[model samples]
Target chain A: MEEKNGATSKAGDWRSYERVLLPPVRDLHRLEVYEQNGGYEALREVLTSDKWDPTSVTNEVRNSGLRGRGGAGFLTGLKWTFMPPVDPNIPRFLCGNGDESEPGTFKDRQLMEFNPHLIFEGMLIASYAMSITTSYLYVRGEFADWISLMEVELAKAYEKGYVGKNVLGTDFSTDLVIHKGAGAYICGEESSLMISLEGERPYPRAKPPFPAQRGLWNYPTTINNVETLACVPLIINRGGEWFADLGSHRHPGPVLYGISGHVNRPGVYEYPTGMLITDLIYDVAKGMRGSKKLKAVVPGGSSTPILRADQIDGVTMDAETLRDAGSMMGTAGMLIMDEDTDIVSWLRRVTRFYHHESCGQCTPCREGTGWIENIVTRIDEGAGNLRDLDLLIDLCFQMEGRTVCALADAAAWPVRFTIERFRDEFEARCRPSLVPSGGVLTPALGP
Target chain B: MTDFIKDPVILMPERHPEPVFSTEELVFTAEETRQIATWVSQYPTADGAIMKVLWMAQEKFGFLPPEVIRLSAGALGMPYARAFGVATFYTQYFKSKKGRYVLDVCTCFSCQICGGYDMLHYLEEKLGAHAGETTDDGLFTIQEVECLGACGSAPMLQITNGPYVMNLTEEKIDALIDALKRDQLPFFSSVTLPQDEDDLGGNRRTDVRDTLTYSAPPVAKTLG
Candidate 1:
């Protein structure tokens, strides 16, 4: 937590930190350029060499300690192991989740646009390890341009015998298809993504039947984030031990920290996990815009709890560190807010987003999101009493753990945590109670 | 208090409306039929290709009316109601007529904190139409949309759900509206990261034809 800005390099400069996911190579999106920079070599090595098998590859990823980059920080290799043993009679699928629709997250877009071949290579490697014949990359429809670009690149890969039947002349055969999702945030969820791929309304399924057990079309499937798959090739090439020693010991490997909102340099920076929050905002993002005092920071995407400026003194960008700091490392897309930002209006907007994207599947989520949005908007408009604050918190409790998916919890967390952390701000916007004493009416009122 | 406790209503789509296209026009062209067949082959079941085929239909036609949705469902050999449900679930699928250009302004959390509503209001005033309404001239429609995954370039808007015009300003909006008036679409501009400016000579992508550098976001005019 002592500002590990230059810890990775002897030069004591954060810029010296090497970018693994998005290397400093130009034209990496093209097949030839990516191959020149050691792109599909990992896939080629895995398919041809006797050193790696399905189990060994999974073990390497598990040993690397790489977690899911799409909000949930579950172990990628462990998730792969959950898949029932491969059967030739049944078809298994590997879904590369490119549905990067989270409000404050945009790093996956950069990866899909600029370094698409890395993702393809990673997917191919993962397919070989999982013994999956067909893989689907579900990209959000808003990324039509990127999707098209990736399609062209994928076709080239297929033509070169990297993805289609009999990959690299080995027995390993896999088909990688790019499935475009029409604008739904819920499809970003693993089960919902599978349902969307199967041409159904994308409502998230219950957790008893996880994706690995029964996924797309009721086949054993494993879903990995686009950025998470992009790391597979790196782990294969450089060894899992090297990846394990790259960043935070608990959550190792390079992560794409997408810094946005009130920052001078608001863009995706590839640094190892566990980068200091202060260094990210101050040093990496070139300090706050116009030198404004930092008021709060949403440590991850909008669903992650917002941290007061004082509370993030020694916070780092890792799952455990952020969890210990009373937030989740949900995508690591930090939305920084300056002192001038109105907390009430900001929370209102955040609540409105959840309300707008509730998907209407569960009663708690559909109704709870609407109720939360109405209450927060009233508080924002200075038309609420002090009791409304308590009411809002109570509403969150009703919705938090009583839903089909995390969307309800996502809707509830911002309202609950924002009021808990910034009660003074919400109280200032609300009208004072008419009855002064708690549970006691004034004598004048009785008269 | 009345606003907070409003009753919920399920507004139904038109059950029987005048058809926009005739029976002859509803049929897909031979080339389009071949394309749909190719999409169907990629999925495990024919239904999996419903979204791609529907997207193609929306592209060929201006929007998806009930008949058009039925046409797409028939092309995929699926039920019409299933396709309709899919279309309604996604906001990108145009269920009705829209302007030549649909400007999706991102006013989500990141953009909101960085003057997203300011740009949205500017467009509303310039076009004489509020969000979700097409302009009177039928040239544009301004929609205040959720995040399009480009939060780094806050205050951005997507033109016709296509190219993103990022890091928006008043002057940029004026120029964009004028160009769009003349039926000239803006070029795709790649946003270069700040680290690329120092390490890789201002732009990291050599394949990109145009690039926009990231700068400090402008302050919001009104938080509300």
Candidate 2:
């Protein structure tokens, strides 16, 4: 058995890296098994021990080089530091985002549904570090099963004195509430999550008054991903130095990659932060479905730009490498597509999701997504002319970086990247079949 | 760059369930009010409990009506208009009365490739109702929505807004409809929540663990 060091990958074989969060054990969901496997031991140690203070916890996290496992890989400890000093009258909170709605992203759902106590334990330690008493775990509305599973686990935690006031007979206390989102993808965003939590529409709020400053009823709040918080207890149990040396120096720790789409075996896998794309796709996920030639991979979630197979041949699946390769490690979704996929039809299907999910708050996203959807649909159905292709490119540029939220940019990337990488396919599919005169299929200019 | 697509891109304009209106005021029973009171205690403010109040109102009333929204507002000590805003905004809350079972089939990118459309088409043929229409028998209403994050088990459906039976099949749908008609389905509430026992899915007990919970160790922990 490994010593379970957090720093420096003793992982001679990356496949067997430290299984801090997603340990491969059945019945680990049981409280007895979880406690036996060193679960909640960190939280108990932090609250009961004299050596580790709240500030020390924060500093350790900073040193660990942990980044947010949500779309944006922001430093986890740095995000905690953003919280304003505790105001006597004002309150602070830690929001655990369980609303995993990204199309190809199902990693959060795994943690929330299976080993839910990890999330609860992580939230308790996080709340303790920030000196906040209350934390809310927001699961997606459609994830009713997850909601139920969490409810059962939380009841166990409270009954055993892991959560609720005076956890484990310590001066520190914590309150964790489970919130079910009401079927909105935008609500996954931190501000939009706050809006939904407030019993309102889940529209992303503008920045400057970020959640760290004035969040959730105008108080300082830190919103962390389900995967991000799930890593906290593991980082706490082993020292920060141990965690920092676990993976890549820049973005350290284990990463949960959700592989779906055209994979022979589609499921979530956790690996050291800087594993190669080929290993994840071929070795870990068992290669493409039907053993077909790999065409493209959405290195991150569908939001990040797509990476053509050629570009990702030797690339590592980390934030920096994917970014350098014209993609991102957005949630590490890693959707696989085979050579037989119709790029045009795929783009049409992909673009329509953005259009349908647009919050209708920002002009560019509200209007631009619809435009892209219309044009792509026409092209896919052979109703578009050559003008539609250039028009699609123009629309992509206009919508990117032009919305109130990053969703517009996320909405724009796939459209631009799909066409950018597969222009020939889109062109080949362009033929006059059922060209609607004035609707989505309408040619922008004379054909 | 393209003025062509400037036209409105409304999605599933047909998905809007017609409002179920009644001149009579909507009210909750004593038990319903009592159960919701427990949730309200957990929230810092009454406003925060609106989702629970609305969910309970829907669970009890079958669908959220204008009167029920107003009634929920009163229960939560929130303005009726605010409750209306929330009920209207979310896709989960149905405005009109649906058939006894509302079939929400997911047609997102993940589900689409895995014969999700075939399931929708099959349901239309089986139930004699289109995607957004209720059957004349008042047994089922059908509609399509985006991803529910259950991609691993694609071609899934949330049976009448309860348990999500994934990796869907025609045979399963037939059995589900039969059980639903007979009010004999068990997994939606019993196993899914261990609370309601409303016949959606079975409860997950260590003594009776679901087949999905595997004995095989996860790949990451092996091969070290």
The superposed Cα distance between candidate 1 and the true structure at residue A5, in angstroms, equals 16
lDDT of 2 by residue, B1-224 (tens): 78877876765576645546553637667887887788787666778889888888888788888888988999988999998988987888888889988889877766666567778887889998999899998988998878877665666788665777666678978888888889764363212221112222423344433433111111111000
Highest DockQ: give the candidate number.
1
For model 2, how does the per-residue alpha-carbon lDDT over A152-251 read when each residue is reduced to its tens digit? 8789889999998789988788899998877888988889999888887667889978998889888899999989998899889888888888766677
Off by over 4 Å in 2: A1-12, A431-447, B1-25, B186-209, B212-224
User: Number of clashing pairs, model 1?
Assistant: 0
Give the number of the best model, judged by TM-score. 1
Number of the top lDDT candidate:
1
Worst lDDT run of 10 residues, candidate 1 chain B, spans B5-14
TM-score of model number 2: 0.88
Per model, kept true contacts as a fraction are 0.84, 0.40
Instruction: Tell me the tens digit of each residue's lDDT in model 1 across A168-204.
Output: 8987889999999888888898888998999877888
